[model samples]
Target: MRIPFALAALTLLLGACTVSTGAEPEPTQVAGAVCDVPDDLRPARPYRIPQDEVAADVAVAFNMLAVSWSPQACRSGKDYPDARYQCAANQFGLTLHGLWPNGADNKHPRYCAAPGPAIAVETVRRHFCMIPSPSLQQHEWAAHGTCGWDSPEAYFAQAAKMWDGLNKPDLEAIPTQRLTAGAIRDAFVAANPGFPRDGVFIATTDGWFREARLCYSRDYRPMRCPRGLGAPDRERLKLAPKGVQQDAQRGVQTTG
Candidate 1:
């Protein structure tokens, strides 16, 4: 699930480039104008990216990330020369389930029947942002099941583009979530050659980890959450809350 972004966007993330969110933008004054406008502000417009559009863009992203099947793998080249092609089966997996707000319980397995490491780009995205989760939303609509599209997150996110569009907005608009440093590492580890934990993935659409902020053991105990926000770290001042992350066990169920 190593989905590559546009080269320029990739560079921006890798370089950890700072866009002007923190500091005040310089002011611009027009002739005979007493009021000054900030140069950094984008045009203000209320946007509710339609579900169809969100699914479509998401689909484009998924296709960009999906593995290509060669003629051999497609099985149409059985009559052709001995040629190796991409493996269509087990290429990648994803699932956008109903938001498991209550949290995953003890019965939650370390490995999900879905979202294999092969295609976990969306998984990584989940760890970072919570809202505008088209995949999760679509999964909740679960009256229909699409094959080769069982991975709920993959299909829903893409389908969202068709049903609606995904937009980037702040605070009152886009649902954003933050990751504990641990959660970020956990995702990287999940994609590692042989991650020991199965179903060990933590799913949260909003908020940062309480235990993580409190310095819990690397062992990620969803059941052992410390109460309330504790001592502040350097970045604590910069933290935003989509709402606090509940105990790990809370993810066991999703609210329909």
Candidate 2:
């Protein structure tokens, strides 16, 4: 989910059977399998960030967590159906963007060290989508992953822990209408107690939901989002109709 801009926008679904009870229903499966696929490296309990000596910003994000995904990926036409970048948006509603390190500032440290073996493509697909592409994966490792752990597996394993903790929102729960950024944040707050209103950051291109970020303290606890980070809480946003995000550029309106 790391990008070059102030914040990067990153790009979900469900089980063996598919279901959509509303106009903007979220997916519950992926590739005809249960969306909640398990990974081999998942820890028996939540991985806690160590309270050892570290920089102040790194310490600030110890225990916090957030969820992010691209509604664009679910829409068709933007990416070829068979392209390596295509997403199973219709199957597993919201794709898992990477679990990132939250910082007190807009920018954070990256490429802290040399990366180890590249995470196998198969391993990545087992848990989430592949829109980052292989090259982006390497970049994410150097920029964000390396700041925390040594190997790609260890960094991603910890990321998996954060991804598993949050509950995906039911986009269908909202009426088929434009939503304010504040409204979207409220929905997440309703589902996730202890996740502060300020902790949730919405990244969008105009109105489309690009990524939903959450800030945390070094101990893995939720904290308020940094000032001037994320989309405005009151900004009105739109949900691209299914398969239409390919041409959604015209509709994109915000910097995020």
Candidate 3:
């Protein structure tokens, strides 16, 4: 499936741009992720993106780095065919959701402009490892990128740079019993010294780990979230193990 033509047109007119951890314990040091780009990958299909209150007109307050737990995202969408590339392999751990610009009082900008041209196929292929979904990447560019960036390339480049700068914790190594929202936050702070203790905002779905939204300054320095978003500190969390095929099908398990 291809992105809608209207969205594509908007994209052509404007290009542009665009997570967490805890520390109760020192998290296990895992090797950096190695993404195996798929040779047969295709562009994402059309997906609806909800409109929001503001657009490019809103003053940029702070930035947000949204990261999703791949297993949870995949498991939830396992029945859908579009999800195959990400869900079928179960090779991903955390993945980029998007970089967002926020305004005061919880009002964020979105769908800043109509969709322009479909994102360049090469651009989609380039970041497929980081986002895993072509449609999502395209949607992000249309919904949020237009507000802050002049082009798709610049938007994605900034997102990739921020994503690369992060030191992610290995969730698979943590015992389930210790996986509370606060524990996850602490692990992130431990992994990156300058990161504020309240910087990471844990998001969950039915108690399962969802996304981690980390707050940042306009210049991208770590900053405390204005108001904690998503699950609370003491909330118990569940996560599907990384790279385990069966775990993806059965959902998250509590095992040490």
**The 10-residue segment with the lowest total lDDT in model 2:** 39-48
Cα distance off (Å), candidate 2, residue 39: 16
Estimate the overall C-alpha local distance difference test score of candidate 1: 0.24
**Which model scores highest in lDDT?**
3
Per-residue alpha-carbon lDDT of candidate 2 for residues 98-179, written as tens digits (9 for 90 to 100): 5566555554544455555656655444434322223334445545676777776776667666665666676546665647
Q: Distance (Å) between predicted and true CA of 46, model 2?
A: 29
Best by TM-score: 3
Model 1 RMSD in angstroms: 22.0
Per-residue lDDT tens digits of candidate 1, residues 1-256?
Answer: 6556787555543331022234552222111111112223221111222333122111110111111111221232211111110111111112112222111222211112223222243432332112122222333323121222466465445433322211111212222234343333244234432322222233222233211111122222222222222222212211223221221221122222
TM-score of 3: 0.77
TM-score of 1: 0.20
